[model samples]
Every structure is written in C-alpha cells, then in structure tokens.
Target: MPSLGTDPHSVRQRVEAMEKVLERMFVIPGINKPVGLDVILDIIPGIGTISAAALGSYIAWEARNLGMSKWQIARMGGNIGFDMLLGLIPWIGAIPDLFFQSNTRNLRIIKRHLDKHHPHTKTIDVQPR
Candidate 1:
C-alpha cells in the first residue's frame, strides 16, 4: 500500500473530504448539531460506535502518511480514543464529535509539521539588507 507521507497532496485532499462529510452530511444545520450519522449510527447499538471508531482510524492513517511523528500519531490516536470511548455513551458522544473536530485538528497539525520540517521543494531566496 502507498504511504500517506509519500503523497501529501492526496492525503490532504482525503482528509479535507472526510471533514466535509462530517460537517455537511453528518451534522444538522438548523440547530448546528451533529445529529445525522452521530445520532442514527450511534443508536444502532454496536455498529454505530464501531463505524465511528473506524472513521477515526482513517484519520489516524492519514496523519501517519503526513509524516506525523510517533508522538503526534499517539496524540491523534488519543483524540479518536476519546471520541470512541465517550461517544459510545447514549447521548454524550455526539456532542463531543460536534465540538472536537478531530480530523480537522489533526490535519492542521500535520500541515504545520510538514511545513516546518519538510517544507516545499522549491527554495526562496532571502535578500539581506
């Protein structure tokens, strides 16, 4: 399988797409709440929680591809872990997902790390006064 770190553009696009799905499809507009997938899938007993967990894992996978260090990966996993464990509760997990925005946060972290460490291939000259 191709690694995410090898292709930052594709990884970024995938993460952005997932965020859109969560924001647009899974969340409701009127009250500005996460009620679609969070509520319906979560109410489905075991599958709902598992599906959310899987979604979180997908984000983690992208983070790994983005060259996130081990520590960063662990932190990313922690976000999903909290989402899964707390979200398994009847009415609580949905609220957390609405507020947490784990994938979005992770994406930012990955971008920052990549920019700081790898940066772009092109080099810009700084003129000294």
Candidate 2:
C-alpha cells in the first residue's frame, strides 16, 4: 500500500487502487464473475458489511478532498449506503452485494470530477498484449 498524498494525481491513483481492491480484485472460479474485498468481506455478517462500507466511504472522503460538489458526494454516499444496507441482509446479502458495485460507481464519479477539474491527472488505459 502506498501513502495517501494530498495532490490530485496521487489522490486519483489511491482512489482507483482502493476501488479496484474493493470491487474488482478477482474472478470467481467457474462462474467468471469478478469479486473483491467488498463482496468477500460481506461473508462475516455485521462486521463485514460495516468494514466494506467504511472502505467505500473512504473513497467519498477522497472525493471531498478533491473539492467535488455536494451532489456528487451525496450520490457516492447513497451508493455506499445502499450497498451496505443490502450487505446487512445475512446469507442473501452477498448475492445482491456482488452486483451492486458501489466502489466502482463512486470511482466513476471521482474520475469525472478529477477529469473536469484537474485535467492533468487524467490517465489513459492501455491494454496489455
């Protein structure tokens, strides 16, 4: 893990990395679906859901630091809240939790903010051969 920095570029990188860890870290065997700490952590009942929400909230906090508008931050919070609530459902929560990628959504919001306000931090995604 890298130290969180105050610059927009570093903040963008940290947020992207955190989103990846929370929402797209691995592919489930045989099923072909990606999973991350968000879904995996949901298996532990109350703690899992809360822990995942906390991690998700950290992204929103980063967005706040980037000077994102309240509307965007609220939407990000709503995404996390919905996901957290769904994850609280014991046994069945993980099923829905797998589909509702709050962190990914939040990441999209943050990216848009950074792209619009801090254009230099924008990065291109290159596919590996």
Candidate 3:
C-alpha cells in the first residue's frame, strides 16, 4: 500500500529484484560465489559495460521517484560511473565486476533511505513471490 504519496514497497521490491538479477544470480559452483548478467555481459566488449550501465540507471530513477536528496542521487550516479568505468577495462575489468556489485550497493542506499523516511513500511520483502 502506498502512503505519503510514495510506493516504497513496490519500488523496493522491483529494485531489489533487479539488483539480484544484475549482480547475484548464478553461483560459481565449487567456488560458491554468485555472479549475474552484469559480469557475464562484461565478457562481451563495448556493449557489456554500456548495457550494465543502462540497467544500473534504474536505481537512480527509483531514488528520484522516492524523493531522495540531490546529493544522494549524485552519489548514486558516482557509484554507477565508477562501476561502468572500471567494468569497461579490457580483460582486467571482470575481476572488479566480480567484487564491485554496484547495483547491490545502490539498493542498500535506497533501502536505507526508505527505512529512515518510512519506517512503518520499511520491512519490504525483496524476494520475489
């Protein structure tokens, strides 16, 4: 249910789901580490980083819809910028993509803001039903 002219529950769920899909979908078998389409896409040349960056923009959009401060949005953009720049490097970029997880990081920021601004509706279930 929406309150205060904001729909944090739906927004949070969608953002978190996309975060997992972008950064934590598949396991590396014996290594037991998770990697998603973002890292996989990095294997592709120019399109990978751009595609990942394009998808990452959704987090900033969600933050804007939530009425987050400009500074927060700027910080979010910086995160995406760093992720895109570093993830675009030739072969070495994949190493950072494995650890950077920008979408997850942005999700944390959104979750924090939602928790603080709307405590009553803060307990959003990120898992898809």
Q: In candidate 2, which residue pairs clash?
A: none
Go through the candidates in order and give each one's C-alpha lDDT: 0.64, 0.91, 0.84
lDDT of 2 by residue, 34-122 (tens): 79999989988999999999999999999998889999999999999999999999878999988889999999999988888999999
**Worst window of 10 by summed lDDT in candidate 3:** 1-10
Q: Give candidate 2's TM-score.
A: 0.93
Off by over 4 Å in 2: 1-3, 126-129
Better of 1 and 2 by TM-score: 2
Clashes of 2: 0
User: How many steric overlaps does candidate 3 have?
Assistant: 0
lDDT string for model 3 (1-129, tens) is: 323334777787778778888998988878777899888888777899899899999878989999999998998999899988887886678789888888888988998998999786577465532
lDDT of 1 by residue, 9-126 (tens): 5565576557555443654558655433534455556678778768767878877876678999998888777767766877666666667666556656766676676676223434
lDDT of 1: 0.64
RMSD of every prediction: 7.7, 1.8, 3.9
